[model samples]
Target: MVSINDNFHCNGAYVAGDRTIKCWRYPRSHGSETFVQGVQNSCNPVFMAVAERLGADRFYDYMVKFGFTEKTGVDLNGEAVGIIHKKENIGPVELATMSFGQSFQITPLQLLRAASAVVNGGYLITPHFAVKTVDENGNTAKVFEYEKGEQVISEETSAIMRDILESVVSEGTGNKTYIPGYKIGGKTATSEKLPRRSGKYIASFMSFAPADEPQVMCLVLIDEPKGVYYGGTVAGPVMKELLSNILPYMGIERDAEGTEEIFTLMPDVNGMNLKDAEKILKQNGLDVQIRGQGETVYGQFPPADEKINAGTKAIIYIK
Candidate 1:
């Protein structure tokens, strides 16, 4: 197991071969801190040190094992396999840059899939849109299954990663994505586009919910966003907004103590038959307050996509 407390000094710059890698906190040293602290700080030198320890061979092997060297075999066509330095061509500078996720290119999906393995009990899963097809009446028509590839890391290691990543959201650079009463694990990145010093970047944040037992993962990438382009600052809020609405819609209950608060999205019941609307509201664990005696719903309070606690009363206007 990799030591979370491995000591590293980040004086904001690391030199490898002819290249100089600088941390985001360049010109201001973080002095010395544990590996865990380095992750929290998003310190570049810590990762460069770790890469040095792993060496080129093992690091390149991990890149291949994580499906970085090939397409993820997704159902979609025209999927591209990202670029990675050839094993023999990876020198000290290459390894250092790659350690902090530069030097090579990877699709957002590829990064998500690899990140998933680190917290998903170490299983590499194929991402797909549908698990099964349903008939018009909602009867299961056919089932589709994707491969759960080999375990890349031990469950114990996955657990540790989960804890560390959770800290990233709760107390680190990804703090902007944190929501009260929910466990979140995430990483933030600001990737510089090609042409080196080009003033362009893709700010991104990758997150998963219920850090101890993840049920959903999200990757938000903002391409060449204007002003304040750091991932934690720009993309973190977007990720937070997304998960805030999505988690409750998916019926994932909040983990607050002394309370079991479950939430669901408000369905658009306007234009639905009164009885049908009532049924749908009831199914979503909402109590209905019908206004005016009529056969069809004309309006609804707490409108569609709003997150409401389960058993909450929904006011539906009829006509």
Candidate 2:
């Protein structure tokens, strides 16, 4: 989250129409990251450190204010309140994962519910895909009767938070989600749920921007991306592609003037070495990771073929 906010700090929310309805419960903190830094980096450790201060009960209170415990009651059936165990019972690992958006399972609606509060004017909103529903032999009514959730955080907090979110897309974990000149903010997350042998991963990216007011927000989830599965790798790129096309279609103007500079990127070096090819890649704005303490480069992802913005995750099969 720190990573994302840093990039977005350059652009905040854009205002839109009033919430479907108003009245509400809604919903961060200290560190080297500063508010925007923590958000831009999506620093789970930082967010967890803050959540610890907020404590389990306070965190749960924020959850409640966001309406996580209640059913959203959208027009369609099948909706579930996400699971949140007793704060006292929640352990460090569990809390850490939740802080970074893992461990707990939430229906898409539940996820959006929390996100609504984060970017939707400091108020949680019940979402609906349909514009309106026709009444029984009469007029059409708005599909969602927006009941304001709660004001969990201060407006000042919300404003800074929006700026922080923008940093995510601008220069953080969510850089892949940037759309030329538009301001974007949100998070990208990856989960390790299966055995290592299975070699599968879940990558997800979520964003809301034009921070003055958000006209569009989206989340992309890939269950088991076969190649380069981190959210920053698989999901972030996909979100960027979609946003680049959709933002304009939605008539959302770019905050900055258009750009023509195209970046010529270098290769990925995830499981590479401090020496050899890994060093070469780093010279071009790329980064590296090794499996063992061993210094030799091994296999790598993005496999020296795909064209992408530099710094895309490329895990190596280290020696």
Clashes of each: 0, 50
Quote the lDDT for 102 in model 1. 90
Clash pairs, model 1 backbone: none
Kindly list the per-residue Cα lDDT of model 2 for residues 1-319, writing each as its tens digit. 1322332211111111231111011112123445456566665555555655566667767767777677766767776666766667666555544565655656767776677677766776666667668888878765645566667666766776677778788888888887766778878777765463477778888888675678788889899888777787789888888888888698886643543233434465544454766667666556555555566666665677564446665455655
Q: Kindly provide the TM-score of model 1 when superposed on the true structure, using C-alpha atoms.
A: 0.80
TM-scores for every candidate against the unseen true structure? 0.80, 0.64
Q: Write the per-residue lDDT of candidate 1 for residues 26-56, one digit (tens) a residue.
A: 9897889998888888889888989988999
How high is the CA lDDT of each candidate model?
0.90, 0.64
How many pairs of residues collide in model 1?
Answer: 0
What lDDT would candidate 1 get against the real structure?
A: 0.90
Ten-residue stretch with the least lDDT total in model 2 = 19-28
